[model samples]
Target chain A: MLDISVPAKVLFHLGPVPVTNAVVAAYVSTGVLVVIALLIRRSLSSEPGRLQAFMELLFEYIDNQLLQAFGDHTRARKFFPLIMTLLLFIAIANQLSVFPLIFQVLVEDKPLLRLATSDLSQTLTLGLVVVILSHIVALSMAPLKHIGNYFRIGAILAIRSPKDIGNALIEVFLGIMDLIGELSKIISISCRLFGNLFAGDVMVAVIVSLSAFTQFIVPMPFIFLGIFSGFVQALVFSLLSIQFIAGLVNTAAANKEARLNKGKQAALEQPATA
Target chain B: MTLVIRFTHFSTHMEAEAMKFLAAGLCMGLGAIGPALGEGFVAAKAMEAMGRNPSVADKMVPNMIVAMAICESTGIYSLVISLILLFVV
Candidate 1:
């Protein structure tokens, strides 16, 4: 009788594209976030108001934590917006998802804004976007070296003697494993948030449906737990993204991009041209 | 005895249904053990660190929560499997 299955409910379509409740919720939430961000930016000033002061403190705390991971404030600034957006977007989305009205006001007995992140499509999009963004940044920073991270045939080719070929082959094998690791990152990242929120949703459904009288009292504890879990999941998702991006920048695996771009540009470009 | 006959009839009638519930319960129960141990370890470490230096509890708490959530994944997976067994299976 209790169904935890979140079958995608399509409300309507935009000609070719099917628009579900989850998509609509994601759009509305993103719109809400944009407006709030605009309002905050407009109000920010040299002389801070109470709201500005608190907002600034929150930003500073987040920035410092992310910067510590990156170990370079200037470079960290690039990925910081993404971290903040995801943390706040997911936090707010999680809270909105559990709100009573969203589920109560149903089109076909399905909520208009049923937990966006609980939707596989939405979670996968976020996870893939994070992974793609890290690759973009890593490549932009060090194109040749970033490419070298995967198809590390250069190491194999660099073997001077027959004796060294074994070690070079191992390095090449390791590079292939790195490529696989990048793809698995998407599945792992997406499932982590989705599973957590989906479980909470299912649990809530079960508790409420079990009995009329005990429902009100029983669900309150779970709601509190859901709130805490939402914040924790959001934090974990963003922190992981930061750690991944920082790993690329902090490692010798990626060469110094600035030096490569200017002085060693010819040598780096020669292979491509040849 | 009449009592033994009634009990035997109940089990025979509900064998399939009982097994379904049993599997779901077992799946969730056994699956939960790993995460329970993992989270316990995390909490113990967090408590030790907090006790050693009370000043950094702010930093330690969030870190502890994040790690615990990741550790909770095993339990959540068990939850998913059990839910499937309960409802979908």
Candidate 2:
């Protein structure tokens, strides 16, 4: 009697495109977020009201988290919008998904609204976006160093004696591993969110179907857990994104600093030798 | 001879089903151990820090949670694999 599957049920075709219930649910959550944002913007005041104050508090809290992680004000500010967008969207979307009542409305014999993040495609896209953006940021910050990170061309070129060949080979292998690590980063991030949400859904469903009486009150704790974990996962996702991006930025900065130090050392030594 | 053959066929089919369930169960059970220990350690350290310095307790909570979630991801990966084995495979 209980149907559990990975793929979201497609509601109908929109011209040429097939629209799944998860997409519609995602749109609803996004709409809800946009409406709240618009309302807060409209009521903007120097003297903070309840909504404005709460919004400010939320922003400042996440900003503090980012500041703590990044340890640099400019870099934190640079990435704030992306991080904030991710946090708010995911938090709201995930929180909205916990209510089982949303799934009762049947369309074409399937649930009209399903948990959006539970869908692999959506979360994978989110992970891909975060990872790709981090690379883009790193590339923009230090193009040559970022490229050299994935390709050990410099290490290979630096090799002169036979003894250096082993080290060069190791560097090349490590570079390849770094590329694989990037791919795994996307998979881990996406799968973590999807598995948590899908498991929560399954747990609640199992609890509710145990008995007629159990369905009345037994699902409360599971739902609460779902809501709590939803917010936590959202926070984790954004924080992880910040950490990944900051790491790339730090690596680039370190590379530039080392290059500058090497140049300075060369200049000082050339004058001494001359 | 025919009856013996039928029983052998049925037993093999039953054995495959039993093995599937066993694999899924083992996957989840073993996978949960590392994350449980890691999360416990993270909490223990956070508690220790909070007890030492009450002022930073609020700050430590978010970091503690982030670390715990990171620890939990491996368990979730195993859960996903098990779920796939149980349902999709």
Candidate 3:
């Protein structure tokens, strides 16, 4: 029988906490990543082996991506570790879903390991972290300006004459909308990853259960699709994170520049009118 | 002769269950149309750009995929809704 459940099944309890198969799988993947990183670090040398060469290439690719997005070295350098970690972790977690052995290990009749990315909680947490981190970066860059970006109180306060009231009110409304848009960003990103991974799992499960013959080779194409999408999604998620972080800072700086330009123009015009 | 109102619990439950399936199917099927068209348009444009500037294919490829992923978010939203309809509610 094919049983499809949206939520991860709880495998056991630890003290007061319940642990699901997804959590166990996530821990294993994290440990694997940590071990690989440590091994590579300890084996570093001037002359490169195949594994070292591959790791160098991956790091260069990520650096190039960050450079392309930020168009400068400073911000890219600051964000490299966060962006690189996100790319590696997501890619590993996503690709690890296809390991066949994970399906066979059962504890108490429940599968011991399931795809971590297939769980909404896991993806949602990732999305939340990225979005919140961006906000924190923005706040650190320019606190008042970042706060002003979402609340047009400054605009309202700066309205000297009654003639500007209409524009100030409109700016206030748009600010509220921008605040909501940030919340939607969290939902959109997490849901995109979760839906793609879970749908891929469902498709493969359905194909495998179609018939006895399907158990032979029918799932190969579907599995290939899953693998391709996993990589593409990892790339997309990292790229979007870089964009979000850089975009917030860029917009704030641009706004400040524009405001300065406008003030200068007004000062020049007032002297001429006087 | 007296007219009586009938309430068949089993039949109503079955009807509701069938409608849930229909709703999920329709939600996914119709919701996919916009993203499909949008992604097609994006891919076509990206291919055209790559063909014109073959040297920049590397840059264009990643940008194209990112745009397509953003376009696919609406479809993902619907997929989430349909999945909820199917498995949750």
Candidate 4:
């Protein structure tokens, strides 16, 4: 089994630097999206056929979700393509396990494509990208203030008297805690996704292996359950990503306001001694 | 002396057999109990929710499975231990 494990290798190597499986999956995912887009483009009609109609319904459903969640149609529209791509890739990957024949035929030694979300590296990379994009949007909206968010320099500089030093120290410590919280976001998001999908795969494998008679009949229901579970996990992951990004973009103004209020309080207390 | 040696060897074999059986029973028997309870609770909740809102059962079922999978992790851990005992030991 270990010998049959697919080694997702570095595509290129320069000195000690190496590319990774997640990057390759991203490219594969994009290729799949392009193919689907082309198929839709070719088949599209004002009066839709089955494929076109189905595609339209899916597109609308995802679009409506984005609109509802973000409440900014423009930003939602911009994000929709990426979100749709994720949904499609995850859906297809999850469905791959159902076709045991395809696995036997295509996978000479290893599966042609494992569920991308099952891999920790892929999910973690995607989560990190979402978080980083959120920060980018926040910073673009208020570059100088966002940069100052980490340092709390303005709060420190507001300390006019010796007594305020203790407060400044506390603020700095809180900022460090905030930094750690951001890192935890990546771990939680990735682990939650990887754990669910990988465990489901293992469960199916065990069920099928339990007995020859049970194998033919017993595992069928669980396979159906796996499909449903896969869809939900993908949706939860996307929703959490959207929520994280939305929170980051929306919180910048509130954070700045709170900082200003604190600075004001410190300044007012400073004059009492002087 | 030969009779005494043979008796000691037989006792050791019996002890080893007893340990294997104990390991297998404990690992699988205890492991399955938690997940069975968890899955039942989840199913009950899901059925109740579906009864209340039959229209959205499609959405609810999928969400329930995701929740159930998380709950089922403990069962999987137990299964792993049982397999290790059966195959490795």
Candidate 5:
């Protein structure tokens, strides 16, 4: 029986920096993705071929999701490329386990390529990117208001009396909580993807090792489950990214609504006083 | 001295055996129950929703799958613990 626990490492050095199998796997996956993209791009026609049609279906599905998520068709179209790429990369990485060579050839002394999502570094990096991008998008759409979100700059700058000190304290505390929540988002997003993919890989390894007879058929059901799981994890990551962006947009909307309501109240009070 | 030493050794062996069994079997066996119930409940709810609006299965199924994965995490944790006990211990 092969030792599935050990990963095959392909080593390369740039200056003093040593690159390992995980890095190679990421590069290889990226290359594969590029090739797939090129193939889809080349195959496009006035009347769609089967491959083009299938690709279009997937694209349209993701495009619709982006529309629903951003609540603006123009914004959705702009962000679709990045979000769709993330979804595709994750989905492919998750399903890479099904490739027989991944286990047989890749599992020598060290893994040449472990599933990209299974690596903690990769998942965490991806999570951080998502969070950072969400924040950037929020800032771009509502510059002054979004800046105020993190520091409550408006509240701090507008203090008119000593009693406002209490409100400012509350705002500072809420700001701290918001910062912690963002950090927790990074941890949860990374851990959730890592835990699921790693557990599935471990399960299949153990199940196959139990008995040679069981190897052929016993792991089939779990493999099926893993495929379903791969798709879900991909969707969850993308949806969570969308949700974060949506929340920021909604917060800006809410701030606008509050200002409008306050303006109305001020207008009504003026007439009453008169 | 010999008699006391032998008694201590026997008790240690028995304790190890008990720990091995409890860690490997009991943790996972018990953990499976909650996930099973949770998955079934989720599936039932998802099915009801799908039945009401069959056209939305594409959206619904993906959401259901995400919900199921979260529910499955408990079971996965138990399995990880059990495997650790069986192999690493």
Candidate 6:
């Protein structure tokens, strides 16, 4: 009885682009987020109101978690914006399905609002963005070491004899494996959220069609569960992203250590001269 | 020959559909067993963590959610497989 498919139903075309319901839902959510942000911006004051106080408390809590995860305030501050955006966007997108009247309306036969989190394209894109951002952040700070992590050509080239050749070959193999691991992270992260949310959506669709009389009251609990699952999935997406970002800190730390060693050597030489 | 196939279709279709149905049922039941145990393992460990240090409950809860989501992947995979058998065939 459930008529859902992986390809989000096309609503209309925009100059050759087929705009789907998922895109519409995403845009509407984005609009909601932008309006809320603008209102909050306008209401900014030294004296905090209830909404501002609540927002500040959330920010503080997230920042506290970041500090705990990164173990450094400055590092946490650097990543707070990315992590916070992911959490807010995902949370809103997930909860969009639970709000009534939006998902039921049809435009040319297809419903106008399909949950964005349920779409593979959306989640995969988000996962790819997180991974790419991680690499870009790492690459910006430590270009050579980040490059070496996935392609250890320099290490391989330095092999002098037959004995060292085996070690170099192993390093090359491990480097390739590491690159594959990064790709796998995108698949796993995207699919895990997609699977959970999509399964819930399908289950509800099936349940709603089971009987007309019970439909009104039967789905109430599932709707509540949907809201809870949305919150959890949103948190999971953001937390996994933060973990990926945190993974890069080690290389950055090593880069800093190298610089600090040079600085220490310079300071030692200065003391001797003095 | 065609009428024979068409008239007796339910008998043949029944076996095929039954096998498909059985595959789906088996897929779900077998697939769920591992994740159930793994999730229980996660909860048991989280309980241990809470017992050890109740103050870290907030941290443990989120971490547990993330881990549980990851662990649910196998069950999700099974669900996907079952759905394919039910719908696509």
Strongest candidate by lDDT: 2
Clashes of 3: 0
| Per-model TM-score (chain A alone) | 0.85, 0.89, 0.87, 0.74, 0.81, 0.87
Q: Stretches of candidate 1 above 4 Å error?
A: A34-51, A160-165, A252-254, A257-274, B1-27, B77-89
Q: C-alpha displacement of B24 in model 3, angstroms?
A: 0.7
Rank ordering of all candidates by DockQ, starting from the highest: 2, 3, 1, 6, 5, 4
Across residues A190-252, which tens digit of lDDT does each residue of candidate 3 receive?
999999999888889899889999986989999999999998898888888888878886666
Candidate 6 deviant stretches above 4 angstroms: A39-50, A158-161, A256-274, B1-26, B52-55, B80-89
Shift of residue A260 alpha carbon in model 6, Å = 6.4
Q: After TM-score superposition, what is the CA distance of residue A109 in candidate 2 from its true location, in Å?
A: 0.5
| Cα lDDT, all candidates | 0.81, 0.90, 0.87, 0.71, 0.78, 0.85
Of the true contacts between chains A and B, what fraction does model 3 have?
A: 0.73
Candidate 3, B6-61: lDDT as tens digits: 33554455677788898999999999999999999999999998899999998788
Identify the runs in model 3 with alpha carbons over 4 angstroms from their true place.
A160-163, A252-274, B1-14
Off by over 4 Å in 2: A98-100, A253-274, B1-15
Per-residue alpha-carbon lDDT of candidate 1 for residues A165-241, written as tens digits (9 for 90 to 100): 99988989999999999997887788878878888888888898988875788888888888888888988988888
Error at A234, model 4, angstroms: 1.7
lDDT string for model 6 (A1-274, tens) is 5787866888889999989888888888888889888998899998988878988987887888788778888988999998898888888888887777777898788898999878888889999999998888888878888888889997789999889998998999999999999998998888877777887888788888888876788888888888888888888888788888778875777786797899999999998999
DockQ of 2: 0.77
What lDDT tens digits, residue by residue, belong to model 2 across residues A115-179?
89988889999999999998987787778999999898999999999999999999999999999
List model 2 lDDT by residue over B1-89, tens digit each.
Answer: 99999989977778776878889999999999999999999999999989999999988888899899999999999999998887778
True contacts kept of each: 0.54, 0.77, 0.73, 0.08, 0.19, 0.42
